[model samples]
Target: MNSVLIIDDDRSVRSLLRSILQKKGFKTRECADGTSGLEETVGYRPDIVLLDLLLPDMHGLEVLDKLQKAPVTRAIPVIVLTGSTDQENRLSALRSGAVDYIEKPFVAEEVTLRVTTQLRIHDLIKSLQTAVQGLEDDLKAAGTIQRALVPSEVPAGIEDEIRWIYLPSSSVGGDIFDIIPLNDHSYLVYVLDVSGHGVNAALISVMVHRFIEDFRSSRPGDREPFSLKEFMRSLDRNFQFERFETYMTATCVIADLQKGEIEVSNAGNPFPLLLERKYTQRLDRDNNGAIGFGMVKGSTSVHKISEETRLFLFTDGIVDVRTCEGTRLGEKTIADLAESTRHMELDDAFSKYQALLGESLPGAQTSFEDDVTFVAIQF
Candidate 1:
């Protein structure tokens, strides 16, 4: 049952309103002055309030302001009751936070209808608030689990050689990467970027991460280097657009620790950059279509790693970011930045790269349009 607080100085007016509202299935409380009305509202926590404009101690507008200001009582709908026909006072009551107004000679039927309407509206707002809170809670939990999918520390045998940065535009995103040791001599390093953003994209990325982890565990630790091309084929065959309704871009690299040889593959993702002391090489000569379409065959090429080589792998979020003038930060610019920072510490290099990216875009941007993921390994 909904409750109503009636704040009227006249006993006769309060009696009439209480009798009329109670018959309409409303629980009612009454106060003869503004001070008592406020006190009762905080204690009773009514669904609505019927406030009379002329009170013994304080004006009705003052009471309305206090009701609206107090957090505990603010949500209760206030309907002003007035004996004046003055347009100014009625306007003042509304401006002071009254949800509605009732004239001095209010009819019983009008009173019931207005109160019922406000109650229904208030209930709907409360329902929406509850639903929004639930969704936020679910996203927070998913973000916690999705973040765990990334490598916390570089794979055991290859520590202090890998540096990375991962930033999701929201609580969860479609970008994921890791450097996993296949054995003491070979490691699997890759960055997978699913199309789109938010929860749907995030869910697909998590599934892909799980699939790769399962495949990793199935292989013998001392086995030959994992096949990047075959793994890409498996991924394409499994995550067809008809099944998951989305596609993804990926750059997978197999690094050989003992031979200093690295095999790199690309699938609709930015080509891996081989940054040398004086030259930068974009590894793949051709760019392939994204996975999940089952259209393009996966391809891989081998590169001889030199002592000063640094392998840079990243999602397109970096090169695709645009300035306010619609200038896209192309791959060439990233190559130049990586080449310039080759001799600096890994953390400093990445920091300078990010700072330059921000400076390129004029204005205050709190986030990117897509998830940004970058990983660099010193060979």
Candidate 2:
């Protein structure tokens, strides 16, 4: 049974309330002053507290404030009992943390109804809080798994030549990228973005990442060589919109160290930016729609890479970031930022770019509206 503590200075009033509450199948406790009432509240942890505004030791509003401030007894519903007809005191009681109020000469039926209603409300709030906490725990677990899909370290021999950054809008996000060493002379680097953000988008991204990892691990020595175009086709065929009801944008860069060339294949993603010694260039000009559409064709092209050549692959999150003025920075602004940072070290350049992006946001906000993935590779 739910419990109530009646804190009133009048002996007859306390007895009357206790008698009525016990008859209504409630557990009851009584105190003659605010001090003893607070002590009883802590000890008993009652479901509800009936507090009289006129107490001998401390003002009833002071007791209510203490109850609301305490972590242990804060959630217990408080109903203020007042003999004074002052509207200000009633409002003050509510503002001070009383959930409801009982006027002087309280009716037994009104007291029971108010107590039961507040108890039901309290129970509902507790249930909702429990459900929300469970969801947060699940999302945290999913975020850990999603983070594992991204590369924590660059492949050997090219660790210092690559730099990247990723930020999700929430605990789990739709962006993922990795650098896998294909053989002694080449590496496969790619960045992918699912259609949306949060858990659903993150689930699809994990599926795609696992699919690519499986393909990399299961390739046979005697089969056709690793082709970017064929890989795109395989991804498109497996994750069609008819099956998943979603789509993804991706850009894959195959860097051949021995051949001094890099093959770029893109599908409905931002064009890869290539930084040379003298000028910056945009690779993969053709716009093939996003993957999972069942009709996405791969557009693969080759570009020469010198020691000074730096190739950048990023999702639209970077370019689509809105400035304080609510205008998207756009591809040209991103290109200009990349060109301006070309003189710095790779890591420093990434830091500078991130700072610039942070400055573009309105006011003190730091996070973007979408998941972001940025990768830079120097041959």
Candidate 3:
């Protein structure tokens, strides 16, 4: 049953409203003054309130202010009751969050209809608020699980200085990186980026993460260095045209610790950068499209690294930023930044790169505020 609160100083007016309200099947509570009315509004927690503009000790507008300010009573729908035709009181009551106004000479049928209308509206708002809260809670939980999936410590047998960053624009994002050891000598360092944001994109990223983990476990620990070309092919075949769209791009690097060799196959991602105190080497010549309905037969390249090498593998979001003049932060700029910061700490390098992008562009901040996931592996 819907509950109604009636606040008025007049004894006869309160009696009349109570009779009218009870006849309409509303459970009513009455208060003869503003003080007791506020107490009843909070204590009883009615679905709606009918407040009188003229009270014995205080005005109706003051009562509305007190009710609206208190959290416990703030949400209750208020319909101001007035005997005087004061436009000021009506305006003040409405401005203070009253839902509707009823004149002192209000008809019983009109009062019932207005109260019923406000109650229906109140219920609808409550329903929407509940749904929004549920969605927020679910996204928060998904983000927590996705962060847990991000690889932190390096694989076994590799004492490399592994530094990585994953920053999502929202509760969760589509950028994900993982390091899975395919035996003690070879490990797969892969970064996958789905083209989009929110739960749908995050879900796809998580699925890709799980798929790669399964592939890592499928191989024998002592197996020959995993073929770079074959790995890309397997990924292309797994996410077939029939299933995933071609927008999910990846950069998968397989490093052989025993041979001091690293091979990278692109599935539409930023090329890996080899940085050292001496020089920088940017790998691959061709840019490959994402793996989806059609496989572009992406370019695969191999390189040998020394002990002083620091390799960076990242999503394109970090380097795809644009400036106020419509200039995109291309491969050359990013390559130069990586080379200069080669001697600096890994975390500092990443921060400086992002800061430079922000300082260069006007719309760059919002457009490039995408999910950035990158791994820096130093030997």
Error of 1 at 333 (Å): 3.4
Give per-residue CA lDDT, model 1, range 301-378, as digits (tens): 888887788888999988787766688888988888887888897778888877866675566666678888888888
TM-score of each: 0.90, 0.94, 0.89
Q: Clashing pairs in model 2?
A: none
How much does candidate 3 score in TM-score? 0.89
Which stretches in model 3 have alpha-carbon errors above 4 Å?
Answer: 155-157, 321-333, 351-369
Residue 371 lDDT (model 2): 83
Give the Cα-based TM-score of candidate 2 against the true structure.
0.94
Cα lDDT, all candidates: 0.86, 0.87, 0.81
The 10-residue segment of model 1 with minimum total lDDT is 357-366
lDDT of 3 at 239: 74
Colliding pairs, model 3:
183-221, 246-292
Of models 2 and 3, which has the larger TM-score?
Answer: 2
Report the CA-based lDDT of candidate 1 relative to the real structure.
0.86
- The order by descending lDDT is 2, 1, 3
